[model samples]
Target chain A: MRYAAIEQWSRQQSVLHRRDARAKIGALLAFLIAVSTTAPASRIAFAGYALLLAAAIAAARLPFPALVRRAALVLPVAAGFALVLWFSDERARAVALLEKSFLSAVATLLLVATTPMPELLRALEILHLPRLLVLVIHFLYRYLFVISGQARRMRLAASSRGRLQFRSAAGALAVLFARSWERASGIYRAMLARGFSGQFPALAPPRWRAADAAFFIAAVLASVAVRVAL
Target chain B: MPVIRVRGLRYRYPDGAQALDGVDFDLEPGECVAVLGANGSGKTTFVLHLNGLLEGEGSIEICGLGLKKQNLAQIRSKIGLVFQDSDEQLFMPTLLEDVAFGPMNLGMPREQAVARAQKALELVGMGALLHKAPYHLSSGEKRRAAIAGVLAMEPEILVLDEPTTSLDPPGQRELADLLRALPQAKLLVTHDVFFARALASRAVFFDRGRIAAEGTVEEIVARFNWTQR
Candidate 1:
């Protein structure tokens, strides 16, 4: 029942964590937009953006290896799309496209590292994001790690039992998928019994004040500066 | 008066598997009853019908209100179900939110919803777990929190399915104690004979999607083929 791995990164601390999850999210969206708008040739702006992200990582107190690993796990799939840019006749343009994608990833990584997934989802709800999308994302975050953990155990058990051939891996994936589906179904039923309607009710109302406003304005200013400098 | 009345209830899964075949039963207010069954014996299907979660043939009335589509919201608000697996029941990120969900859905103000959630947690002796994530709680704690979620709704009839399946001995005993102290009508589904003995005043044995036997705790347990206990 312990969700240590899934819940571990979410440490509510410092002024950064206290910012309305909505504010952080809005800032993150703006940052992504700014990163995307910059030409890959704007090395100075990219460097400055990287530095700002590092400052955030430091404030968040996220582990370097953990953060890098999280980033790396994403890189391969994105690298494929980034690979597309490599074929552009103008090498600089290709470099720019690749850099844009990587910088975008950096923004997302920092957002997740600084703000917990659940809080982010709650913030999205407060911001009037689609309820169904928020619910799907929330459930995905909560259950993905748990389900993956189960999958890992299943693989381990199969390997130990001499069933870990290439052929067996597919079967193992199927089995894990089935189990997670069943678990999710049962959990949903249980939730309904406890008065879970389609919408998740907030336990504590999010309060906005001067500090929240300050954070929002500061984030927007940073995005504007990045945009103008690029 | 009976808190729950089920008459000739029939249910079939979408795949056409008969889950509950014309089952009839009654649960009095403020009394504890055990529903015993083998796997696929329709115990879960029967209990789910009590809250109108799964629609079936025949009728279920809770406190005299029919559990039809029109009466579902009212019927659901009055019955709290504790599912067998706590993990399935306590999926909210934090325990407090999970417990508060029911009352909040009932349209209680935020502060009142939170107060009721806290009170329910206190009832289950899980007050210290408010800030903790549901995934971190021990199985027993999760179970208590699951029960607290239903308790927060202030349901008149409390339904539990296999309430102590995977618990340690101490955890099991604690759950038994908690159930014993609960004030609402209890319709418990379980295979644990000892648990049935400790918790229920009466017992109903279900087999192959029908009620095979029903009587006082000793009478049903003694008369049935159940060897455990």
Candidate 2:
């Protein structure tokens, strides 16, 4: 329940934090799309994408080691699939797939590390994303920590009562899920009563300044240059 | 004049268990009434009715407005309900946003909503913690912020469920003081006998889905027959 990992990553402030969250989200998504669209054999293009993601991460001033640790979490499963391709004769295809996944992960990590979850959701809403989808994501983010807190408390209580076992853990998890769902329903009613219409109000509006426009232009030109050069 | 009125109110859960049965109650403007009851005594259910958060059989009115299907928005605007669990009530990321929610929903302009939020925060003495996340606050702070959120609505009636349920001695004292300072009709559902003693001018005992006793503070406290019920 302690989503301290995410909370900790988002507490950092820098130039990256100052930039409009909508721009960051859009750019990172675009980065992912560009990287994924390119063939794995486009070694220079993949390298360029990785460098761009790295620059963004550095600009955010997040701890590199922590970011790397988080980004590395996908390796175990991804490595499993990469091994199959590794044994195949299509080395270029294997490289492309691996590169695509890596760049995509980096883009996501950089985005999340720089922009807080709430702000990111606000950015999505501002970008004219579907209200229902935004609401779903917002609730998930908000309750993830709360439910986790309840689960942790339940586990602690179980341990204190000498009922700590894998079976007991599973049972506690189920109980926590049920209680959290009830809590969620109550919260939903509370929200409805409070006049929570479809959209979450942003703390501050995002301004698409001249610098943001420049950033967008640079991102687009770089993406195009990579595709054509490769 | 009565800000809230309930007569012959009956509510049964979908599972066929009656939560409130033929209960009659009235709350006047600016009067604090503490509802005393044990678990499953229908105290919570009654407060839920005050805000029209739940549906029941028979008549219930808020600020002289009947809680019919179409009157929900107006009833909600006139009555602010603070749930027992602060986590549930304070869902917004920051205290300011959460407090501003009600006013904004009432169609107030952004500047007015924000000003009201700031004032409510000050009323609860939580003005400094406007930007803080609810999850980051202490239990007392969170509770105060939750109440502030309700207060920001500028409702004529404030319904608080267990206002001091999980607080330490100092926190309980602060809560009592805070409740005393607020100038609004308050319907408090709680087991804090001492807090009720300090804040309520009248008391009602709910037992087995009915109002078992209702009278002045001294009248109800001395007649502690509810312990047997």
The candidate scoring highest on lDDT is 2
lDDT of 1 by residue, A1-230 (tens): 33543256665466677777778787888888888888767788877777767777777777766775666565677667666767655566666665666667766776766666667877788888998998889888778767976887887788788867888788777888899999988887766665566767776657778887887788778877977875
Task: Provide the TM-score of chain B versus the true chain B for each model in turn.
Answer: 0.97, 0.95
How would you encode candidate 2's per-residue C-alpha lDDT over A1-230 as one tens digit per residue?
24477576776788777667777776776776787788766788887877776777788887777777778777776777877888987677776776677678777887777777767877888888998898788788788878888888887888789969898778877899899999899898888777666556655565778777677677666766676676
Which regions of candidate 2 fall more than 4 Å away from where they truly are? A1-3, A76-89, A196-203, A219-230, B225-229
The true-versus-predicted C-alpha distance at residue B181 of model 1, in Å, is 0.9
True contacts kept of each: 0.78, 0.49
Off by over 4 Å in 1: A1-6, A195-197
Error of 2 at B96 (Å): 1.7
Interface Cα RMSD per model, in Å?
2.0, 2.1
Model 2 chain B poorest ten-residue lDDT run: B220-229
